[model samples]
Each structure stands twice: as structure tokens, then as C-alpha cells.
Target: MKARTDTKEKIMELGTDLVESIGYPSLSYQQISSQLGIKNAAVHYHFPSKESLGLEILNTAIGSFEKMISNISSLGLWEQLDTFFKSYRKHLESNNKICLIGASASDYQELPESMQAAASEYLVLVKGWFVELLREGREEGVFHFKGEPKHKAAVIVSALAGGLQHARLVGNLHYDEIVEQLVEDLKP
Candidate 1:
């Protein structure tokens, strides 16, 4: 796997920043070009279309979380789970908006297959991580489950994501509180 050139990485990094700040629906290549102090052609040279750029940006953001998830130690899975949820809550606090998954899923069906695939892959990864963690906890007798851990892990991931969306919808939901409550419930 060849590393991306600095300029190409810069372009993608800028694209992610712009999308997070302005939003994907309102993002413009012209604005990105202007922000980079380059001609629109430069932006197009790196990304042929806005959708392609959006996908790259989304992938980059997801890659960050993947790195963090991969870094989690199996020796401390419950602690790792708490850290993951805490990090997620911090993201919500900082962004003060729905996450990429939440926002993208809202209109996911209308998006290109690549974008939809990206969103689907994220949820799959989250569920996969939860399954691993939950299984570890159950093996240690620190977690009790009425059903299969894998199935419950999927349900928990979906519920946590749904909770975030609900918090965003209700306007007064506290993300930290929700996350803390989730952590408590997950504890043995």
C-alpha cells in the first residue's frame, strides 16, 4: 500500500474539516478551492466530484475511529468500552450536531452506493467491536445476558446509535448523561 502524497492528504484533510464545519449538503468545491487558495481545478484534480470528495472525507473520519478501536486492549475490554463511549460523547459535545453516521443515515438511501456502503460498514464495525467486548465480559463472568452475546452486542450498538439520534431529536438530551448511563448499565 503506497502512502498518499502530502498534497493529496492535505486535500482530503481539508475536505473533512470543511464538511464537519459547514456540513456535507452545503459543502462546495469552489469554497474548498478558495479556502486552499487554489483554483477550482486544483480541487477537481484531487477529487473529480463532490460525492467522491465526501466519501474520502467520511472515510478519513471513520479511519480515525478505526485506529482508536484497534488500539483498545483486550485485557481491559470493559474499560475500553467505557473509553469508546466517552470519546463518542466528547465528539457530540464538540460537534454539537449529529454524527456522520447519524446524519448520513438520515438520507442514506438517496446517496451513492459508496456512501451507503461506508455507513453500513461503520455500523458493522461498531457491532463487531461490541461483540468482541461483550464476549470477553461474558467469559469473565462480568456480564450477564439473556440471549447470545453477539446478538445482544448488535442490539446494544444499534441502541446506542439510536440513543444519539434520539438525543439530537429531543433537543434537550444530554449526551454525556446518556453515555454515562449506558456505561453504568453495561457494567456488571
Candidate 2:
């Protein structure tokens, strides 16, 4: 039983590495098996199908982000918001400045319904954090927004994702600058 579990884990790990390195659509099972030094049938035995493997990769990626963000601590609500954004920025910098969840979420519609549902859950949870922070900040007089908190949260997430894409495409240092500016904009 333990050996079976380990094999499943190993396959999932390889799948995640392939997705993060080459992207989900381009990740070939045969290539992953070659990298794993195993027969493609071994991978197929564990995953049954490519969609299953993709779903596992999606789960692992989202789980990793949740674990990373759950570690931040702050004394006050505003400080919590600051810590959240700052920690996220640091995560981006530390992870080669890549948006893992956002990248995976982009391919959700193309994946199976199970994967899309998982992706939607992760995205809604992330958006909820921003919404909570924005609402709390406004309540405490630490933030002023012209729109609803949930809408503001959506804007923040979209802008951040858009800025990252622009930075990648334009080869500019303005990405971090834009994120920092948004942090300030979230202030009262």
C-alpha cells in the first residue's frame, strides 16, 4: 500500500514539474515518463488518463499556494492586508516571478470539468481574501474605494495578472512597480 502511494506521489510530482516547466498543454505523458526513467505504461497505470494527471497537477499547485499564503501573520487587519500583498509579491519574486495558480487557471476551461471546478474553487478563495481585506480596510477607514469590495477585489486580481503578463511580454521592470502601486492604491 505504501509503495503504491509513493508511486502515485512520484507521478504527481513529475506531472507538476512538467506543467510548471513546459506548461499543461505541452506536457506529454511519454516525455514525462522518459524524464522519470519509466515506461509510459507505468505513468498511465497511476494516472489512467492525461486528464487525471492534469487534475492532480492542478490540485498540487493550488494546494502549494494556499499553504504558502496561510503562513503570514499580522497584528491588525490593515497589517494583515499588507502582509498578504507583500508575502504574495515575495512569493512571485522567489518563484522566478511566475504566477503558478493564474497560469494553471488560464487552462481550466480546456481541461476536464473536475479540473475546471477545482480551479474555480481556488480562484474564488483567493478572490475572497482580497474582498475581505478591502471590506475590512474600508470599515476601519484605512481604505476608500469607489466600488463594491468584491468588484475591487476582482479588479485587483485582474490588474495584477495583467501586469505580470505585460511585464513578461514587454521585458520591463515595471511589473513590480505596478504591484507596489496597487498596494498603495488599496490604502485609505
Highest TM-score, which number?
1
Checking candidate 2 for backbone clashes, the offending pairs are 142-188
User: What would the per-residue lDDT of candidate 2 be over residues 1-188, giving only the tens digit for each residue?
Assistant: 88778778888876766665456777788887887788888888888888888877767766776775566434576667666556545534543343545666666556678877776777787788789878878988988877899999998877766665566566436567777777677666
TM-score, cand. 2: 0.77
The TM-score that candidate 1 achieves is: 0.78
Cα error of candidate 1 at position 174, Å: 1.9
Residue 58 of candidate 2: its Cα lDDT? 69
lDDT of 2: 0.71
Q: In model 1, what is the error at residue 16, expressed in angstroms?
A: 2.7
Give one digit per residue, the lDDT tens place, for model 1 in 92-140. 5654555667667775766688988987887777778788778878888
Candidate 1: residue pairs that collide: none
